[model samples]
Target chain A: MLDAVILTGLTLGAIVLGLLFIMALLSPLEALTWWAGWTSHAPSPGKLSEEVREEIEAQADRRREVGARPRFYLVYLTAIGGVSAEELSYRERVFLETLTEALPEAVIISDVYPFSVTNNPLTGERMLGWLWRKIHEKRKTITGGILATFIFARNLFNVAVSADPRYGPINNAGVAREIAKSLYRHDYPLAGDIPVVIMGWSGGGQIAVGVAPFLCLGLDAPIYVVSIGGVLTDDPGIAFVEHLWHLQGDKDHFHLISDILFPGRWPFIKNSAWNRFKRAGKMTVITPGPMSHTGKGDYFDSNAILPNGQTFVERTVEIIRDAVRTIQPPPPTSIEEELEELLGRGA
Target chain B: MLNNSLRSLMAISPELQHALLVLFLAILSLLFGNSVVLFANRVSRSQFIRSLLAFAFLFLLTFLFWTLSVQALSAMVFGVHKPFVDVFIIVSQSFTPFILGFLILLPHLGHYLYALLRVWVVINLIIHVAHAYDFGSAQALVVSLLGWLLLELATSLSFLKLDAVKRWFLKIATGKAEYRDPNDLVMAYVRAQRALMLQAAQQQEGRDA
Candidate 1:
């Protein structure tokens, strides 16, 4: 009887352990954290709050009075876990603030998308309710562990298929659409034609490239991309951008593995469509030595001596300023000129 | 040892040779581990034929791991896709080069010949993998290197441990038992080889004197 009882207990324990293992494998916490990190730069007090928005508008109006073109700099912050830019940790906020201060001419606007749904000041039950609604609207069933396993497997299969711009879970298209809508929205007024520059850091670089084609089509202006230690798959849509500057540190081992994971980025591989687009001068790759994957250490310090005398940050800033200055606006075309040219060709 | 055994078997009668072949197959099946054959026999409710077939299939599958590793590494790294069974067949057939392992019975020169055959087998493996997976020369070279690393790890973990197990059995049978750790046995073998080489050199010097 004792043996039988022990055997039964062991069997039950094994079943419980198996179930727990499956539950742990299918937990959404990791995916949630990654998404949260990706969209942590969502516009905060400056864009979301009414007082800050009015103050920015007043500043822009004053700048416009000085005959300056209303230049909008939309910077995508590097990965950090926060609902919005307002809630970003002290260090992250300071970094973005410093960047904004450096670009004194342009009106700086920044936001995180697709994950902006998580941008709420509330806590506990309110956040849970918000998450529940978002999941419910997406028609995702997360009640049981078995269903979660199926969802996870499906995501794995999708990643294996391409890891392209159409990766479903991230909803790159939806994010692009949302950004386009925000840019066109009447509330945030801008004078004259808006010259917008889109920039992202780390994983945000992939998001920037994914959204560039959409921004180019919607905004009717040139789009420039700056990717720093970013993981990006070769997508033909990147051709729509005026120029893409990929700045990577030579010591960045993590960034190098991105090429292995996403084979489209491998330069030597032939017969890839992305490689053709890359060879067309649309993409410029710069490997600045003595730089870490995270632009930290000697790379981040302004006084740090480099082989080229200039510090890493100084070189990076110079490259970015040069890229911005080299943006040539599209020449105007009139209907009369077009008709005359066509008539002359026919003659 | 395999060549000597085969030569001795050839001097026997025809009927004895047939029986010996069956016994050899049976022993081979046992050496491969009877668990798979027993499982097959239990599940199928068949005679010895099912077990024999299962043994053959399992033996072939071992070689298939080499091809699968190459294919998987290529697919993951270069996004090259190929049929699994096609690779398996080519890899299994490429095992012909390893038949030179029997040459180990040819005394001192046998070891050199066997080492050469191993390199030939690796070349055959690389060719087969490249053909089956439709990889370019450079990609195939990378796949072969990675496949070799995978095969070496698998071999050390599984097959190489059998030598230590055999040594343990011999030690017990001879009653010359020494408490030797299995992990340290590799170093012991290296030391033995060095001693043998030194003895050979001293003998050569004495002969000259």
Candidate 2:
């Protein structure tokens, strides 16, 4: 009886291992199929929630009232654990709000889902949405943590797809289109000459860098990336980024994976995109004191305080605000100026 | 019976037809290319039918040689003597991953994928060799390494110019291997898409005017 029980357990374990092995082998098919147009049948922007539509409308109204054209646009790409385009975690929402307050000249666009080329979020518009939702619900449990690796692995493959020379171009083009559509919806003119900032957190940073060149070409704008504890690759898109301001806490060692896995990031590979950008004086690496990569003292943690009495989130906002100020467009005509001009005409 | 089967096979869908062609070309390039070169003098190319027969014979000869090499190494290194037919079947089956050899033609990523498949073949060989001979994993690994070393020594001794063989295989697998930088293609594609979008917008403006 004991022998039979042992045999059954071993068989089950083997089957699970085989399935995982097969999954790893087939991970490249996602980008391959998207490039070949075999999948990604979801609509371009998918379904926008009522709240998102209302927010877009409010943004346009505010711009008109202020008599100011947004000097620049800030697009925030969420982390890999993000489940949807319209949804933002509480801390992420707070960070964006802080940015909006600090840099009122910049309009924030955060609806483009970076994990997918078609902007299809994991929990909506995808055929396997329910499966991801199931995994996300139990992600804190032991078995759930194990299952969550599948989601992370799938997104990691996307990062590789963007880094892959043969597939990066096609996938980046698709992602650029998604961002362009989001920008257009937010009253960004196709012919607008404003600079665009792509702010990515965690794995979103790699996707941000991967899509920069194509996004710039598509929108005809100067592109910059603000990476916050991002695991970045030595992608060719770095060449096209006008400036890249990468912020990390000294305790944040997650990015070392890129250094270990990608030979291009090695110091010996001096001609790599990362090294080239560094040499060109267009790259800035900022270490913002002691903090973890994601957990209690991560970049977005509002309660994590520094010696300077500022929260971690506040410091991140301050750094990004300074970066945006460097690239800010000439001040637009303010509402007060327009009103004063009308009063002078009346007098 | 053969004539009837040929008629049915020719009636397959276009997608199936393309798949079959891709499979045949991949097999021809991966399985038969090196073997044909090795047996060039022995293969009679007087007629199409004769050449076809020679191709099958060369494939079998290459298979026999591979089986013998693995069997000899296993016996010498681990004192395991699996049956000749069993070893032959295992080695031949290990080539299954090469069915996707057409992917090796992909521009930049293809080169890496092909290397990965080669690694996969080695791993497949190690697992099957250990199972078939009932040897420990370490013993099987040593035997595999010995076989690989022997092949390398033969190549280094000028049995075949490795570079020339690689160039020939690459040429057969991917004609002209033109390195297309993804950045250049993406820039061009994005420019084209932007132009189209602007054209559509202008058309809408004209209609409104």
Candidate 3:
């Protein structure tokens, strides 16, 4: 009877412990509950309280006095072919949409048509009429499988080029020049000294590198250009970065592996992210911690964040909050230390 | 005589110098620990294991404390283990989807390279979690959380500050807000679409001409 009593006690204890352990694991997950907890806390004083939410509504009230809102636009280029516009991910769309949403006083510019001479029948007519048609016809003789493979290879090549600054900047010069002209017009109130952030994902990033030099040519403002997945290079760094922000997601395997398969100045941005943000006495290279090259972040449960469906509009609202944030990078390390830091044993 | 000879021997070998240098570094690490390890670019393997141990210990301690706290208390008591566990699970799970998705996409990768990447993601996730956890005092935590939200707001503002494209986005977003007659937005969007199509066609014709 004593032995039976001990076994029952042990079984009851085990059941209690397991339930406690599992509950412990699951509670932080009730994100809505945590959010409710946050709301219960008193509102923090000052600009933070004003800047994060309902204050954006009040921001429009001052817009008339703020006058012509300074404008910035990114002319994005997706891969030459392959992934449809609809196939692009939420974050990818967010990168573009958030900025466009921002200009209470400006416009966001983009072209959906593929800049290909073949395959994009709508936009292809002029260029395909002469060169691509004959070339494609001849190539078609080599079998559809070869054609399909070529298309895939070409699409991959655009993504690769987009990641590197060297070959990409020149891929679409006319578009870059036009986009630059529109954003740089002198009429905007924030003109002359306002900040403009231009970014591109994939092919758009490549053109950004090229666009930088043109921006340098026309403007003398304290402009900040941040390119997320694009490659920009060739012209001297001084010509481009009055201040530049580059955000690369370390988790994204596509860019990480592409660096090995085809490499470039990507290491400059990638390595900086790895090391402490450089600062010189009072000045710093890029901002640090929460403010970074990567856009505003999303938790895994970002889907469950708010009202109803996890649609593009809800995410876009979140994305807007992500993009406008900034922090001055930690003061950069001494130059000698930085060089030794980046270069290592060599020199 | 043995003591005198040992003193003389200690002065003779370069190998002894190398050994002493290594010993000094190890002692330094035990003293400064990870602050020294931070000198490395990514977390070193030793540092990684150490952080894991730190996390595991903190986790165990927090759980034990919470369990102890809740045990004798009424059923209304809450356990404190949830935050750390969620942190650990998030760190582990976030990487898997991307890596697994990529693996399915690129199956032939060598095991060693894949393992290296897996380790890299784990370390980064740890950094992210720790940054979130360490805000100073309760007063400080209150301030920093607000700062985090401000940073969020500022970023959103930066996007809103863009040019022509912003208008289009506002239209789309406001259109979805649906207080309006739904047909107005659709009609506007359709007209814009038509205008863009016509413009592209015209540009193509001009080029052909």
Candidate 4:
């Protein structure tokens, strides 16, 4: 009887793992088909919150009035639990609010959904989108919570798509285009040498790195990534980033998933992009202390207090704000310089 | 000399790196007895030299047809002209992922796995073509889709009706011909197992009685 029970358990385990493996392999299809024009129309560049849009425009106006080029364009990509670019959880809203208040001079964008290459949120209109909406709604109940984990599954698969060299370049280009559109919508001067800062929390870290190379190519701007307890792989995109600041809470063991999953992250794999960046002094890892990966004690949790008498959210904002401040935007372009650039392009 | 060669390999363009990786995978797949080799071996009735030669010929033909079809379609539709050698390498190397084609033999998930492998091959083809030709993602997609469509129409209208062609395609596609209809085989196996279980239960009951 015990042997039979063991056999049944093992069979069930194998079936579940097999199904998940297939799901992972199939995950990049939507992004691939979208790029191939086989899927229904590509999602338009996602909409920004009107309030944030006005704030960004106000900053643009201020920069113009000062006759100074715009500084950093800070884009935040939320963790896997995010429902939409605009629909931030209360904790996430507070976190963004802190960043906005701390960096009034910089344009803050939180509307780009990192999980989907097309920026189509899980709750948005697509095939099986209604099912995702239902699952999200029931996320609080036990069974609903299990169903809602499919959101994580989808995002995790997207992370794989970004990391998989086979699909990464094509899919990341789509995502990079969306981000460029977002920056342009906020009045980013395409001609200016303004830096773009990507702040990725949790799984968003991997995506931010994955899309960095394409983003850099499209905009011809320096790219900086700030990962807050993010799970990152040794993606080739790391080579394109100007610098990376990774903030892991002491208690956030989940960030080590990349170390466990990616063989390239192993010590013996001496020449991975991650290691190259580290060797070049282009990556920094900071432990923010005491906070966990998510929920009550996550980086964005205002209730989580540190030994330094600051909230986790406060500490996160400070670290990111300082990182952004350290990056000096290029000096304003003189008329002669601008004319030279145009002439060069024309030639 | 090895260090210099390694440095040279590292210094090459990403497109070449990708092609080289795909070639490595193809060679590895062949070593592990890929479907094409297995099919040829089966046809040759365990004659190793004959099977190897036939496999090499089929692979060469496939490589030539795929590259030319894609190149012709791209030029006609998109007015893009890439070097024949570049397209040939990209097209042939894209087939490396079919090494995983054997996974299709799994019961219950076999057909889905087969479909996934085809999708993988298609995506790989599009990606490498785009990189090799410097085509935008959309253009690459159009080229790949049109190329496949043209090949499908040509092959179907030309050779698909032949019984030998059908048998050969089936053998190459499914890795092994013995389990051509895997689902039916699985169902039959299940039925046999159920009969044995019933027989054992009846005999136990008889002894108890």
As for TM-score, the candidate ahead, 2 or 4, is 2
Q: What is every candidate's alpha-carbon RMSD to the true fold?
A: 27.3, 13.4, 27.7, 23.8
Best by TM-score: 2
Candidate 3 residue lDDT tens string, A201-318 = 4444444544444343322233344444433332232244444454443333333444454323244653332121222121122211122122243211223333345443344334
lDDT-better candidate, 1 vs 3: 1
Deviation (Å) of B53 in candidate 3 = 72
Instruction: Point out where model 2 deviates above 4 Å.
Output: A1-17, A40-66, A140-143, A328-347, B2-113, B116-186, B204-209
Chain A TM-score of candidate 2 vs. true chain A: 0.82
Ordered by DockQ, highest first, the candidates read 2, 4, 3, 1
Q: Score the docking of each candidate (DockQ).
A: 0.01, 0.11, 0.01, 0.02
Clashes of 1: 1
Overall local distance difference test of candidate 1: 0.49
Interface RMSD for all numbered candidates: 37.2, 16.6, 24.0, 30.2
lDDT tens digits, residues A1-347, model 2?
99999999999889877765555445445554554434644212223334333444444455455556688899999887777767777889988999899998889999998877778878776678899889878888999988887777667666666676656666677777788778877777545467889999988898889888877766667888999988898787888899999898989998898888776789989998888888899989999778688768888889989988999999989989987789955334333343344334431
> Each model's TM-score?
0.41, 0.65, 0.31, 0.59
Q: Can you write out model 1's per-residue Cα lDDT over B57-99, one digit (the tens) per residue? A: 5444555566678668878999876666555555555555554
Contacts from the true interface found in each model, as a fraction, amount to 0.00, 0.21, 0.00, 0.00
Residue-level lDDT tens digits of model 4 in A1-347: 99999999999779867867766756666665564444555422223224333434454455455554457898889888887897878998999999999998888988888877677888998787898899888988998987766788777777777776545665676677568668866767644368999988888898899788766655557899999888898787899899999998878998667897776788788898888888899988888778799888988989878887999999999988888899977666543444445335431
**Candidate with more favorable, higher TM-score: 3 or 4:** 4
Clashing pairs in 2: none
> Measured with DockQ on alpha carbons, how good is candidate 1?
0.01
Given the true complex, what DockQ would model 4 score?
Answer: 0.02
Residue-pair clash count for candidate 2 = 0
